[model samples]
Target: MALEDIPRLGCGRSIDRIWGTIDRPPTAHEEQCDQCQTARTRLRRLSKATRSLRESDLHNPTMEPRPGIKNAIMDVVRAKVRRGSRILLRSADNGTTEISEQALSSLIRSAAAAIPGVHSRRCRIEIRSAAASVADEDHPTGTTGTSTNAGPRLIINLRVAAAPGIVIPRTVEALRHEISNAIPASVGIGAGTVNITVEDLYDV
Candidate 1:
């Protein structure tokens, strides 16, 4: 029978049965059968290659990510939080007195410049605002009173250039803490968050 007409071999078959009753090399009939010859050659090559690869050493014996990877991931998360907390500020009196993104950025620059041990050239600030409304609780009339709300809350992100001799962790913490405190004190609205990024070190 042609190879195609013969029943296909199953895994449960005996080794002798799988090799097909022939004790010798492929016979004229088997060799002449193109389909059987191709299958035999493929199975032989696969078996040899698998055996050789099983004995090979291809995996690293000791390889791992650097210890700083965790810190890097944390830094990225802090950056995202800072960006998310951004707020835009505007004056209530005139829409013309609006705080453009560029203006807010300039304000951040000015603020950072005023701080000692910081490089204004390498500093950046981003701000965003959200409206807040609250019922007036201290009205003399004691009625519902005129419900009032502050315009919006501002969130700022600052990246300051650090000098070579500065203690990076302490400097970053101090900058963030100070900026957060200063913005609310000056602008009359609470600063939601302040993120400080140190991008590069300056010699000065």
Candidate 2:
């Protein structure tokens, strides 16, 4: 498989392995796979960029995300979850308004982005309906499918780069709190579970 097979061949576990978060060794298939190698190279580049960002932050503690960063993130989210459907929110007139998964994801991303020393990178949202037994297993940036149903519960998963010198647990807690609060206000739906993962560490 080549790089184009990423959606089919490579998933989040491959990324976890690249980040050293996964302890297991790669299988023979993965070790000999061209797609995995390509993914590794790209992921390594991303890791290096985060390190460069850390160095820059050490020199400038007050630095902020550059212009268009949020837009770039949104672009990536949209491309990843284009197959997903929109969510329906209750309105005062006994009507329902549709909120795209991408929009809800933006809210979650914004919540994390507001925190100092945190750079929100990826946000995945799953909406589970009462008729369904479980939430959708598909992750947007990962090799999983996404689903949408009306009046479903929302589960948000966010990946961020935490700056050095910041408390990890506290930072994650802050993201969860802010994201939970932002959901109902923005889309009129209660957030179910807010999962935060610190994928990389940068400088403050």
Candidate 3:
């Protein structure tokens, strides 16, 4: 059932129970109600986000917010919290459509993390013109005049931690292949490069 149907499920107590804000377990009515089940799933995700926040603060005890930083963060958090992970996609007709970047990244992350020894931590998406000048590279073709434009190429960078037993080169290759296929198929954006950086290796 949808969230709108929750009130019809007799009571809203299941949400409180899921968060441990209530002392009792899910009552019989909540146990059988599909609306309550959906609500519980959403609430659990929020709970995990809360725990992640706590862990993050613990790791960076010295990092304090600067002026206006809190508002900037809340703006981002509120947008995602309300609408999930959506991004604007431009159309040739000058109209825009909404697409779920979160959905694409989730698939990519799942594919990478499914590899036996790899766990993905972060994924960043960048779109660059195919003919864009390489500022960091030494090249005579570097643009000084008004340039021609090419279609955008999508680049993905993943930060991951690998387990000790994995072979480094093979692991990176597997990750790249998985990401390459997932991005084009899921998001309709062909990946120019799928870069993986092994930031940590866990002990066996």
Best by TM-score: 2
What shift in Å separates residue 125 of candidate 2 from its native position after superposition? Answer: 0.8
Error of 3 at 194 (Å): 1.4
Which residue ranges in model 3 land beyond 4 Å of their true spot? 1-101, 130-151
Model 2 spans > 4 angstroms off:
1-84, 91-95, 131-150
Model 3 — which ten-residue stretch has the worst lDDT?
A: 143-152
Clash numbers, per candidate: 6, 2, 0
lDDT of 1 by residue, 145-188 (tens): 44332545444556667888878888667666666666655554
Pairs that clash in candidate 1: 86-128, 87-127, 87-128, 87-129, 88-128, 88-129
Q: Residue 133, candidate 3: how far off, in angstroms?
A: 7.5
Ranking by lDDT: 2, 3, 1
For 1-204, candidate 2 gives per-residue lDDT tens digits of 455433344444445555573234656666788877676667678878888989998789468778777768777867676536687775468776888777777777778778887888777787777346234353556543443433577778888899998999998898889888888777766787888899999765
lDDT of 2 at 97: 80
Lowest lDDT sum, 10 consecutive residues, model 1, at: 128-137
Considering only N, C-alpha and C atoms within 3 Å, which residue pairs clash in candidate 3?
none
TM-score list, all predictions? 0.39, 0.52, 0.46
